[model samples]
Target: MHTPASMVTGIVFAPLGLVLVFTAAITPQWREGQARLGASGPGSPLRSGAKGQGKGGARPASAGALLLLRSDGLWESCLQVENSELKQCWPVAGSYRRDPRVRLAQGFILTSLFLCGTGIMLACIGVRCWTDTPLRGVAATGGLLVVIAGLLSLTALSVYTHNLPRLGMADPSKAIKSARFPRLSLHPAGSLYFGWLGSCLQMLGGSALLFSFKRPAYPDCPSCLKLRVCPACRPCPEIPNRPDNDVYEVSC
Candidate 1:
């Protein structure tokens, strides 16, 4: 099998993309939120009366300064206090798991990652240079799988982006109003950007592998000549003797 340069390059890219996507999937930075606290409330430890009060009993300036929330994924959430350098994380709530958009995004992203892994394995098998013949069909199928994976990831990212605002905001429709945090705004994080980039790479690598499916052209034979023969029974032509060379030429 003839392995084209494009296929080799695609093989490299497919695995790299898979790694990035996998990393993004595991790392909790898909979405980020920052809220400025105005004086800590019931659940917060940064209350004014707690620790280190001045002689005049004035509130510390950094008491309600910065609160950071980061999500590694739909499953986990993290909180960080900027001023005190305190950090905490916990599993996502059942309400978040019940949300349709969040569930869809998680499903799609996970499926895409699975497909990418399968496609990369298939591509590796198909593009083996040691084989007598290249597995064009297998490689093409792998490329198709990779393309589908990219599409799935893109869909998940799009859905997440579209619902980001609503996801961040406190929902009045839910019964658990007190459970939701107030005055917090969310934004896309580095991991979300990495996921987007990984999807693009998967698509590009798949396309390149697809392009490698072209069949090699056969070279024309100089020895064979095209001849117009009668529709009736055709007879072989007599050989012509060559004086200079011992070779004889025959026509059909």
Candidate 2:
């Protein structure tokens, strides 16, 4: 007895969650930060004499430009130098492989995505409208998978968020060894928000699906159990009897 509301919700949200999770996983905007390059304005060394200066010189500006940096679930990082328009991407050195937290987060996120996909498939097959006889057990199992997927996603997100400070901190040894790389400060980007939203949707859809389980209405007669056939509309069978003469009578 799946209600129309629950069926619609599960159908809509499960797919929506899948799309959002996939989008979040692929996009590299999970964490973003910018580095300032040089000083700006009339008093700055980059800016020369008042020849180019004007009356509105009071508007101070940075002599150096900002460079954008972003990282994704895969630990692939991108750097946009001069401005955020130009992009160059690369792996995050050996940190992704060597860091335990990174490995755990990666595994959890990947697992969550897999579970979400599996749950969606199962739910599709078990949905009432798709089948003549809806399998309540199958739909419940799918809902369980979706719930687990949501939990895994939340765990992965939590782990990454908790370790963000450490991730952004520059290695003291490397900083002391070379002045080329400076410490970076990273902030949550659009993808992180998308992941959160996706996780919530998964949970909601799963719960709705689980609650949709109920016994289907029974037909009036066992003979009319066939799909789209009603007991009242079915014609009765004919009976044959003979005493002195053979005779047959049809009963409807």
Candidate 3:
């Protein structure tokens, strides 16, 4: 049976975190985006620049538009739903893309947020079904899951709790049980302890993925502090001579 949306968030976090959402291996959304980036790789003008670039002075950062080819010809896509008249992020500018380490941190955060969002969506769905299912044992179970979902979300809000590496995960999946109707968990529950457990698992998986990827930090200014210190002059380096005009400019 397809899993209920209520269980989706927990399940999402439990196995892989939301980075899986971007892996294309698990989620088509990410796969499409990856393929798009890959196909356009060399021709991308922004390829020579950062994932995003700052504009002329305060031009604000831009991530650039993606050119996607389909039977319909070429089009620009955004992370926001395509063709949505309401989305402002179309063209997707100024968003941050991370190197492995930072991206790893970000993956966990995004996954956590996704889980919470899904949990809320499912809770709303459950509420809509509440009137029809109150006498059903699963209805009570659903309500409990909703409450638990909210509480688990709050637990994650404590910040950086989701950094656990999956190597450390402890299994409660075996103990979690469902009384009836839409039983979940591998089992189901009224308490949400299992939901929280899934959240923790996601954190670990995200951390592991990040640790596996090497991260590179680009230098913003090669002339900055540490670089400015010449090894030959470490004790006391001679300052470079400057023209009179340079002194005047400095005085100015």
Q: Which stretches of candidate 1 lie above 4 Å from their native place?
A: 40-45, 48-66, 70-72, 168-170, 173-181, 221-252
Q: Ten-residue segment with the worst summed lDDT in candidate 2?
A: 231-240
Considering TM-score, where higher is better, how would the candidates rank from best to worst?
Answer: 1, 2, 3
Best by TM-score: 1
lDDT of prediction 3: 0.30
Show pairs that collide, candidate 2: 38-64, 39-63, 39-64, 40-62, 40-63
RMSD after CA superposition, every candidate: 9.1, 8.2, 29.1
Clashing residue pairs, backbone N/CA/C < 3 A, model 1: 1-132, 1-133, 1-134, 28-72
Error of 2 at 124 (Å): 1.0
Candidate 1 residue 24 Cα shift, in angstroms, is 1.4
TM-scores, one per candidate: 0.75, 0.70, 0.20
Candidate 1: global Cα-lDDT? 0.69
